[model samples]
Target: MSAFSRFTPLVSVLPSTVPFVGPEAIERQRGLKVEARIGANENGFGPAPSVLAAMREQAGDIWKYNDPENFDLREALAAHLGVTAANIAIGGGIDELLGQIVRMVIEPKMPVVTSLGGYPTFNFHVAGFGGRLVTVPYVNDREDLSGLLDAVKRESAPLVYFANPDNPMGSWWDADRIVAFARALPETCLLVLDEAYSETGPAGSLPPIEALIGLPNVVRTRTFSKAYGLAGARVGYAISTPGTALAFDKIRNHFGMNRLATAAALAALKDQAYLAEVVGNIHAARERIASIARANQLSPLPSATNFVAIDAGRDGTHARSIVDGLMQHGVFIRMPGVAPLNRCVRVSVGPERDMARFEEALPEVLRLLD
Candidate 1:
């Protein structure tokens, strides 16, 4: 039997791939249950009691489709940030929103700028849309704002993507520096400021909502998937000018928002006390991770996000060994995918028991490598 042959040329030309090989797939492939799930940057701390309650109550209503407009969640987010509801657009997650943003602006062969080793999901979206990605290498383990700006100008790129409290390396820039970089970009360029790790970052690290709220060219994407402990809920939002946000409606799935996920997010927002408590726990877990790395004689990079990127003192192969070796013991962790950055393995902050498992597994994994 042969497959249908009427697919678009771009679709036909693209190779099939999964950017992330999830733990579930690993379990299926290796026949090993994931005893400690501390790899996916998921909040191992779990969601708030309030969010759980809300989801449970809404479970009965799952038979109905979610509101196409996502009015309630957007209003709740607006009140939380003191922005108007029109400025918000909801999506399945940052990953889904990324595709929408690319579709809204990218044409085949148009330029899109990003850090070389930045989030891969964004790059995947660019590829799907046939956008030419112009990448700038990270400098000293941080995304080079100057280099990104240069590429944007050089490529005359219509869109650029950046993440604060970045993934893979868990490095970040202070708000003032980030604001300066955003302000310097040309008004014609659209900036996708991914702040998925915002809840775990320090106070001065995030600029005030009002800081970039006025810029028509800037759209900040945030997720409840981080400190809110809601990754499975698939809830995220974009903050932009009302005009800029309306563009999402043009290409978004009218019923994409899950009713329960919106309910979970609304309840999550109301539980600020829970958020503050989780942030504290995240900080403590980060310290615990750092201490464990020190005891193992490896260096753990400081992280504002929910994960630590530990320098394994070697190249990508060595880092891959540590990663694969951990999975052997049912401890699933990840590492950066590119060179230089791949020298570090990223372990997400999790419950004390999971961390204890990681602590127990590290020495044996390194010993086996020796």
Candidate 2:
């Protein structure tokens, strides 16, 4: 039973770990069914009816491989965002594209800058590619732009990752500040501006496409997972200069996109009315989540994403207890992976029924903790 030993040094040294332990895995491990699935910032409101209809109509086309160029989706996204199709690169999701970006820029032991305790998946990708991660701590619950830029300069790091409407804490930076940060980075460094929560974010929170489009070093990633409720579809895209965007084609899995997912995205893009409607619901659900957190005596942070991170008024262990305690009652939620941030449990905005379940379960869980 000896193992074959020809794996690359990087692969050999990496630990076997998943970035996120999904709710399904939790269910299997703990033997409990999730009644309110709001842990991962998924849109429990679900995809628009038009998107669903488009997918169903194209389901019969499953036998065909998706266009490697992703022509139609790119065209649709370009028109939607007021950019040329050449400005876009499609991927299964932001996660996959992060890997591709890391591969394109990182070499063994090269420094990559990111916010400490920010979007673990990007960190995961950096580690997978053998890059040295230079982290800057959050300042006042937002990613420290100045610190990240300093780290990039100090380390001569070729790449950096920053998520606006960031995960775990659900905090954001205004567009002006983000553009300033991008403009300030050294031309030698590339910035991965993750905007997965763009649709849910407030106006003026996202920089207009033209603001940074001229910069070859900045890539903004957006997703259908949060606001469009297409997590299962794994459709996301990156926006950058045509030259920078074309780098994805060099290492990307051609024909890797799902045909139906492309159809879904095309439909989703065309259904702006439905998107606006879902965004309204997302706003309402954010308030609902905050209200519930306040009712339970926890302070909820202001959020522009589909989730809120509530300060549990204790240490990581106490916040963890709330997370575990909720799961025991069939309410699944998540918490930040590191301290200071981990003092809060993150809750995603779900439909009213899921919200009701969480509302009923939270007090019981807190009472148990007390």
**Which residue pairs show backbone clashes in model 2?**
92-234
lDDT by residue for model 2 (1-370), tens: 5766998989989988899999999999999999999999999999999999988889999999999999999999999889999999999999999999999999999999998889999999999999999988888788999999899999999999999989978999999999999999999999999999998888899998999999999999999888999999999999999999999999999979999999998999899999999999999999999999999999999999999999999999999999999999899999998888889999999999999999999999999889
Estimated TM-score for each candidate: 0.99, 0.99
Local lDDT at 10 for model 1: 83
Off by over 4 Å in 2: none
Model 2 C-alpha lDDT versus the unseen true structure: 0.94
Whole-model lDDT per candidate: 0.94, 0.94
| lDDT score for candidate 1 against the true structure | 0.94
Model 1 is weakest, by summed lDDT over 10 consecutive residues, at 10-19
lDDT score, candidate 1, position 238: 98
Q: How many clashes in each candidate?
A: 0, 1
Residues 169-231, candidate 1: write the lDDT tens digits: 888999999999899999989999999999888879998889999899999999999999999
The per-residue C-alpha lDDT of model 1 at residue 239 equals 98
